[model samples]
Target: MTTLTLNAALHLDDFSLEVDEQIPLQAITALFGASGAGKTTLLRIVSGLHREAKARIALNGEVWQDSDNGIFVPPHLRSAGYIFQDIRLFSHLTVAGNLEFGRRRAAAGDGPALEDVIRIFDLKSLLQRAPDSLSGGELQRVSIARALLRNPTLLLMDEPLSALDARRKSEILPYIEKLPERFGLPVLYVTHNVDEVARLASRIVLLSQGRVIAHGDATEVLARTDLKPLADHLDPGAVLEATVIEHRGGMATLGVGTQRLRVPGISVESGIDVRIRIQARDVALAIQQPQGLSIRNVLDARILKIEHYGEILAEVLLDVGGQQLRSSITREAAEELHLQQDIAVYALIKSVAIDVGLAG
Candidate 1:
């Protein structure tokens, strides 16, 4: 596995970022935290955009920054591609020109073919169109395509979708989703939005005050009781890959490992793989196997643990085929049901609760 080790200290006004973390080079490692939590600063440090009083940045085993050796690699030559929050496409350039600018700057033998990037980003119609003439989604697509043309070992994106409207964000999400599969390059994605983290990150680094508070799989990291404020609405009880069994009109039939689910309002081809999120709030407990309930999803789950965080809310940890899934309910509900570890129960969910993993 490619690994990144950073030991740095930076002073920003009254607060400081004294970070020391070893981040694995996975498909996408998200730097997630609340605002002023040093998410952006850490990205800057990695990109060599922000310097530190004492810095050591290395990938795999190569030294990028070391204080004692005075080894500091500048940002321009890091073999890294960066997508700024602004989608900084040059006004003078057309969509095609903006996409090819990176190739023009690369070593003669290493640059991607001009046509390859066009196909990757679906830039056919926009090739001759100017940047001002493109929609927000089109512009971001061009920006990401331009960065990929650099042949970067790693890609850095700083909330690239934050500037767009909901519709635009949806338009650009699939492109971002394809990055890990298409390029085989690790992406250091920075975002304060938790839903984005859930949909995109293969691995996650939870930062608080420039320190790595939590680092693990995306679902586990987001469910931490400590970070609940940021993950309130992103409470996907479980995430599982499913096969699209059939597609008729605007709906889809999905098979999640052992269970079958019917989802609404989606455009998916048959036999394709899709990711599903079972929201914690959407799951209801049953003493026996449910037969005639209006709910469609009923998994035979075992209670693993229980955690109460507030006067009204309590979270139950359930095990579904050795994979942990979360369920949220009132404290009174837990008591009324006499919930405890090792108790066998059924998890009920409706078809409407299922959502496509494309939200910003």
Candidate 2:
């Protein structure tokens, strides 16, 4: 498998970042962290834009930077397509003009046809419009199309959706999700939004205070509560990939591993795959499967571990049909139930607490 290898050290007056990692170039990999956590800086290093850092960066065996050998490849030569938070489309050019500029810069070989890009991004109607006349979501879609025109080997996105409001984000995410599989491209996406991470990223590199706290499969990394950076996030949760079994009576039954989950207000065709995000706080643990309850979803689970956060609360890790799930409860409740590792319990989740998105 192809991989991006990075061994970097960046030191500032108050903050220092040291990362040594080998990221697989299989699909979208998220660089997740809070502000001032060095996510953007690391992305710049990988793109060969931040040359001051002492680093050795390589992509799929090609060395982009080697500080010790005094070798450096400039950003343009790296062939990495970068997307910033702000839409940087030229106001003087029409959408088609902007796209043509990028297409003309393609290195060699046949690049993606303009018609194909326009169709993929649904941009046919907007081609004649100038950049200033487009909506935020439309502008972002155009920006992405322009990048694809370059026929880049890798894509780098620095919180591209941060500037968009909820509705605009929703409008543009589906388009972004299609890029990797549609073009066979590997993307290094940076974002702090866990929901975006759940839907878009297959792997995660969790950073905190300028260091990697955890890195692995998205499901495994998000299920962890031991990391303070992740735990502090508002919606710490477990991400599950499930296939739609059926939708009936205002509920959708999803097949996750061998277990089934019923979510409310979701209408999707049977056999479709979806990504589900269940917040840790929304999961309630019961000693046994309750007979009478308003909750519509329950799964047999085994306690993997329990982490106490001071004296107020505790986070419980669970194994549900071989997939990780997390529950956050009060410390007093945990002590009352005598919760511990290697114990069986029922995980109760309210149907309304789940967030569903298309599986990328």
Candidate 3:
């Protein structure tokens, strides 16, 4: 069992972060929560910047903090790369010079090849240009490249893209996606944006008020009804992969489990398997086939389960061609409609509710 044992107790005068739990830190672990939820605080402790009262933090086998045993690895020697919200690039240095700083500071002969990282991040053009001369996206790329050059065992990113605009975020997303593929290392990404977590996180850690409320697969924890209070105030949805068939006019045809769903606002080419998220509230169930509706996407499904959700609401679970879907409805509606498990029904959904995020 690959687990990160984190049993820490700290006090920041009037505020304390007391957490005792083990997080599976093998892949990208997303620290998700609202503001003042201690996500950044935990990151600070993990990076060895914040000292704890009684710390017993260990990653794999290396001892990061074990105050009882008199072992506490300092931040400098931790070999953990940290990327703050601001890129924090030195205005005096050029892109090439900034990236080389990590290589120079890295333990003797421990960093990755300098040439490869430069090419991988497409920093050749900005090599001679100073930090002040580069755009936001270019500076972020330079930030990431510098971290990679350090060849750290784990990379820590604290809302790295939060400071960038939409265009700039979109510009740097591809580089972020390729980092895992290129390095094959663990990353600790802290963010409040669900869209970023949906796109990148393999295992998500739900943090609330200086503690880990829940930690598991990105999809499972995000889909949980109980996590609604902790997660961002947004409708729950399931992430699915679909192959784009063709593009016609403003809509794109995609294949999803024995049916073709025409999605709107998709700007991708054919043969690409795009990831989609369909909200539960948008999905409606019917006892019998009731045609003649404005809704376009309809699927045959079997009732899987039903659970109580928000006030005056019940979430209906349906199995659609091996894919699970949830529909939020009123308690009175459920009892009146006599919704039961294994019952065949038709699930109606609109194309606009199908969100095109999280590329599978």
Candidate 4:
């Protein structure tokens, strides 16, 4: 399998950024951290925008930067497409002109055709319009289309949705989600939003104070109780891939690994796959399958592990038909219910607690 390796150290004023790890190039890896966590700096280093004394970076066995070997590739020669948060489109150029510039800069026989990129991003209609006249979402789409036209091997996106409103963010997210599939390119996405990480990333690299805290599968990283403090006020949860089985009467039925979940108010059509994030706090535990309950989702689960958070709350990991589900409850309730590893319990989840808009 192809991989991207990084081992570098940089000292700037009082802050130091040190990264030593290997990332798989097969999936979209999210470089996630809070502001000032050096997420963007790492991307810049990989793109050859930042240079350090002992830096070394290799992608798919090809060396881009090797300080010992006295090799350093410039940013423009690194074959990376970088999209900034501001959607940096040339104000003087029309959409078509900007795209042509990207195509002209590509290496011989590299990247996709201009017409294919336009059709994929739905940018054909905006070809003649200036960048200044486009909306935030439209500009972002154009920016991404231009990047694809460059035919880069790797794509770097730095908070591409941060400048847009909720509506605009929603509009551009679908395009971002399809980029990896529509074009075979490894993406290194930098963002502080856990929702975005959960929705789009296959792997995650968690950074804190210019250091790597954890890096692994997106679902596994989010379920870690030890890293909860760095999660930016978002509840730790599990992400499950499910298919919409049916939708009727404002409810959507989802099939997840032999279990069924009924979520309220999902607008997706049946048979389409969607990702659902279920926060641990939204789930409650029951000793027995209760009767006459208002909660619509109660699945038979087996306790996998228990970890205490602070003094009062405990996070319980459960296995629901091979899929991991988490629930956070008070220690008192956990003890009263006799929760332990391998014990069977019922997980109660309210349908309304699920926000369908976050599903992608």
Q: lDDT of candidate 2 vs native?
A: 0.85
Clash pairs for candidate 1: none
Off by over 4 Å in 4: 235-360
lDDT of candidate 2 at residue 78, scale 0 to 100: 88
Record all residue pairs in model 2 with backbone atoms less than 3 Å apart, i.e. clashing: none
lDDT of 4: 0.83
lDDT (tens digit, per residue) of candidate 4 on 33-54: 8889889888889889887636
Across residues 22-115, which tens digit of lDDT does each residue of candidate 2 receive? 9987689999999999999999999988999999999888999999999899988887888988979988999999999889898576778989
What would the TM-score be for candidate 2 when compared with the true structure?
0.69
Q: Which candidate is the best by lDDT?
A: 2
Q: How close to the true structure is residue 325 of candidate 2, measured as C-alpha lDDT?
A: 83
Which window of 10 residues has the lowest lDDT sum in candidate 4?
Answer: 351-360
Candidate 3 residue-wise lDDT, 1-360, digit = tens = 346777888777666778887787666779888878787888888888877556887888778999898989998888788888888998888788888888888754456789898888888888999999888888888999998898887788899899999989988877776676688667889988887886788888887777777888987776564554343444333545577889898888888778778777477778877656566767888898977998887888898988764359888888877877778788888888899888998888753333334344
Backbone clashes, candidate 3: 0
Which RMSD does model 4 reach against the true structure?
A: 15.6
| Candidate no. 4 TM-score | 0.68
